[model samples]
Target: MKKVTSDTEQQSLFWLIKTNSGRLSEADIQNFKIWLKASDDNHKAFRKASLLWRTLAYAPTLSEQPKLLEPEKKLRKKRQINSWYAVAASLVICMFITLMPELEQPTAPSEAEIVSTLELRTAKDEIRQFTLLDGSKVWLGAGSRLLVKLGSSSRHTQLLIGEAMFDINPNPQLPFYVQAGDADIKVLGTIFEVQKRNSGILVKVAKGKVRVAAQNQYRYLEMNESIHFEKNKVLPLPSKINPESFAQWRSKRFHFVNTQLKDVLHKLNRYYKSIIYIDDPSLGDIPITAAFQLNQLEQLLNSLSSIHNFSWHKDVYGNIHIKTNESEISF
Candidate 1:
């Protein structure tokens, strides 16, 4: 792979693609077409420049993580056009290997198949953002799964599995809805968090209000509020939410404000798959108030140990063992 030594070459390559076939004058297009016909490598060079331009236009993230500039998906829909973009991208991109020497092209997809599906997924440990075929913009949490559909068929949203926080784009003409368990949360244009707990579900509203109807009952949860739906009823009026405490997730930290011990453990189990055993059922009822950065599993165990006489053990793989030897803690 040759290196693009200067910014001038880079800009020229950009202009080649920015100035598309339709953008050029017919006479100029004929002259350029003649130049392209002169030699095989000339066609190759123009193709590379054109592809690089288009790649930059579509996935601007390449500027930051330039490594992803390669078009891994097969160019099937517009085969002739996409192939030129891919090939041209490869050529100009190869030049940057010298000065910005860290860049390397990714492995090409096995074949070109014009892969287009509304289903959204992310590589492990990677977080992604994308607009659905519908006008909805979804911010998928790490390891989250999303399924959406759009077009004249009408707009709809379903939280297939895992956790996601949505900044939904509203359309009174096309109301957006989310299905979580038996409940259906309807919102026009609002920001909210929907987490699927083991038993039922948790809904938190940030900006606008959300209408939550579950199991034949419904409630309008207001801003800065959190509600849990369990046993076929929404929990009594939600206490005022602590905005900062909930934010621990953004920092990879877990926050609990009088959160039940059992519920706290559930969150830990989901985030870190450690075998947890609460031998003393009473401990599950005890309320926990603390903040923790989940980077260290032992740190959490140590915190629990401070308030209760609980035994904890762990393996090399971060599997945790929690159990109390006695029937109840001796206060």
Candidate 2:
């Protein structure tokens, strides 16, 4: 029946609203029961707080019908009853007074500019290109999964299951990283390609320098250089690279320079989404040097058979199989 002004009473009211707003948790129910039974004054305080919390919903209704004020005068004749309602209303007003500034003030940048993560996925034969908030450009190849995590001081993307090309904008203050499995490709501003395959993680630097660290082994690769991670070892790829063909996947075209047949199939399969198997294992080791558009896969395979002495046919399972022709197979 008295005014609720003490910190103890306010704390009790806050907890009462918090606990009873929804179905109570086991611990909260037990705590509430214990707090309510501590003393009769606690029970009276809780009942009054609950009434006040519920009456807040009526504030708009009370405003719409100002005639309700006339009835309050009759209630005020009972000081005990009148004071209890006043205490409930005052508690709510005080709570709102404490919360208004927090609601009105602009939130902090850290809270407002949260480090949100975004995912990008490309279907077979699909390619995606976009620029990040940092002005860095990204190209996702077909059958790829990329997760972007943006931060105030850094840029990070994970090549979860496919290939991606990054043309990062220069920002020495904020480094960029592309994570592929255990390897982390760190760069400042560079054009690079990251591919994850069954063999290992492949990192190629088309421009600028890249630092690749995998399994505690680190290697710095410069422009037109590449590295392959096989388990824990970092193997530098000294093979010839065609800079013009780099990131050609963005256009659904790929260029190869003496790339192995098996490796070529592996890369092409990502775009074609079809299984092209070599019936003879030896065929996999044959080198291929060519440029082909993704849509011209059938023509490319037929062209390979002309010079490579291999025959390809689609089996019942809808898979393409290539094998050495005995008549043309070199001894």
Query: How high is each candidate's TM-score?
Result: 0.53, 0.54
How much is 94 displaced in model 1, in angstroms?
Answer: 68
Looking at model 1, report the run of 10 residues with the lowest lDDT sum.
101-110
Q: What's the C-alpha lDDT at position 177 in model 1?
A: 62
lDDT of each: 0.58, 0.70
Deviation (Å) of 79 in candidate 2: 85
lDDT of 2 at 2: 33
Candidate 2 global CA lDDT score: 0.70
* Predicted structure with the largest lDDT when compared to the true one: 2
Candidate 2: where are CA atoms >4 Å away? Answer: 1-114, 237-240, 257-260, 273-289, 306-309, 314-319, 323-331
- Summarize candidate 2's per-residue lDDT along 39-129 as a digit string, tens digits: 6877887788677677753333333443545677644444545466667666766674463221121112243343757898888767888
lDDT of 1 by residue, 1-331 (tens): 7545333343234336335535665434454454456557656666775665556544322334434334653233345555655666666554443443211121212224212236676443344678765545676644556666453423445676556677877666555567767767767347887876655777887877776655433445667887776655433445468766443454557766677878777766545544455656777877788877767657767877777777666656655556675543322
